[model samples]
Target: MDLSSLRFAHRFDQVSGSAIREIFKIIARPGMISFAGGNPSLAALPDEKVSELSVQVLRDHGKQLLQYGATEGYPPFLESLKQYVETAVGFRPDAVLPVTGSTQAMDLLCKALIDPGDTILVENPSFLGNLQCMKLYQANLVPVASDDDGMDPADLEEKIKAYHPKMVYTIPTFQNPSGRTLSLARREKVAALAAEYGVVIAEDDPYRDLRYRGEMLPSIKSFDREGWVVFLGSFSKIISPGLRVGYLAGREEIIRKCTVGKQSTDVHTANLTQAIVDQFIRQNLLPDHIRTICADYGEKLARMLGHLEDLAGLVTFTRPEGGLFVWAELPEGLNALELLKKAIDQGVAYVPGTHFFVDGGHENTLRLNFSNSTDDQIDRGMSVLKTIFREAK
Candidate 1:
């Protein structure tokens, strides 16, 4: 038999590769001003600092770092991380488990909790990557309603009543693609709901430190008294993404389950990276680094919002206090997927927002990332997008 005739797993029957990854390939061409990926700017990556940390960590613990490490975390990182979680993240974790990235945190959670056909409630326009992760686990992803304040407590309660979901996955702070944060009241309510309903809440908050404006809101995990909420955190947005160091913090039993699940998946995160991040926390380098990043990204966000203001009649977009993405909706009867062809032709690129939807069909919406682009690039890219959207209208 030909290899093409081979049968594949049924889990992928409804799942497809990420649409954003395809856009990344197209945007790789020379002179492409991409607003597609949630990437940090080159200037924010701190190559020099990372180089210094890498050398120091290796010299300090050369043998241990090169060797296999524990599934839980590197010992030094484990200690520093627990303190960082308590002081910075505002929660006292019963346990913490380091993973490859926050994305892996989602996978491990799904592996620990989800079985095929078990329902998982989600925000309608949630993170694309996590949505796909749930689908692969064969969980029925049901979308709850959301508005300016984030996921509605009323609708979320109703969904829980109707579906009796096993888990509720949320990107509570500076949510990806949409760039909306859950309000303080809703954060408390979500934690309460999880405790009452006996459902696990995955609070994916990778961009919590990327705030550009407004006061910081407490994490949902902070209000989680019963230990139903698990906080998934990442250094990808603040530190270098290439480092791929993220962690999971939750109740002891739940974290133990995830730690076991993680053992089979990559064994453990790279010890070298964990040690380097450990130094960052111990030396308290993150505060100053995050401040510099917030300043640069805040300016870019304002510039992008200004351009969007000029196209106010032509488009409506979210004004996020912080986060890399700005979600925009074109006029009705215009399709962003179709407009993307025109954008790529003009050396500009953005992700069509329809892909972020669970069931798909918001054809007028698109997501733009301002963090990776310079002011000149934003002006030029938004100009191209403006002309294309206007012509389409």
Candidate 2:
């Protein structure tokens, strides 16, 4: 018998994510102008500031940081984080558990709540990573229809009644891939529904502060009267992604459960990173930093949209107020999967929208990221995409 014949866990039975991974590999080639990843602009990362903070924190408490720490979080970070969330995010969480990233926040939520075969309602085109996480937990991921206003409350109610799902996962503000925000009224409705149905709501809102145009809306967690909503936050968008600092905010009991799950996951998020982020919060550096990045990103967004205007009849795309991505749909029968190969060959790349869909049927859709590219890159890449679409037509 061969070692390859050894039995593996059934959790991996439906989790083959190789297609997009292959696309990412192509995007990494030299000279590739990639619109595939939701990465913060290099200019936005505070490398110098992070270095200063790291040295300061290490010099202050080097031993405690290097030694093993509690599963809950670093106390200094916990204090600053709670204040930041309450003031900036508009919710006083019963508890907050810092994690490696918001990605781990989702994983811990699943670990704490989901059991094999439990139903989890999701937006039709949700974030692929979390969708895969749900699949690994063996949860039944049912799709809910969405529009310009985000997940429709009516459809959500119908799905809730039909499936009686254990959880409802949502990226409420400036949602991933789609770049759509849930309306304010619907946010309240979602919270109310969660309480009525006894279902948990995972409100993953990493991009809330990335707004370029629209007014900021209240979080679903803010409207959560009961303890049903859990807010997932990340610093990857506004700060350095390599730092990998994010958090989960929810009721005490729920957070306590996630904290236990996190212990087995990665003992705790790196203490030095947490301390650096702590200094950022304590010094109130985010407002000015966010303002600076938003100015540049807003311009990039406008430039991309202007280029999209030239492709008017050829394509239609979301006009998002903020967030890193722009979702687009090509003319019917034109598959984005096929277009991607030509895109990569021409030194441009985008993620085909089909990968974002739960059931994976829409092939004419794609996602573009403007933040990572310079103005020249956006112009060149969009031109390449335009020529590809026109030739396909």
- TM-score of structure candidate 2: 0.99
> After superposition, which runs of candidate 1 have C-alpha atoms over 4 Å from their true positions?
none
The 0-to-1 C-alpha lDDT of every candidate, in the order given, reads 0.94, 0.95
Tens digits of per-residue lDDT, candidate 1, 271-357, equal: 999999999999999999999999999999999999999898889999999999999999988999999998999899999989999
Best by lDDT: 2
- The number of clashing residue pairs in model 1 is 0
Give candidate 2's error at residue 11 in angstroms: 0.5
The C-alpha stretches of model 2 lying farther than 4 A from their native spots are none
RMSD of each: 0.8, 0.8
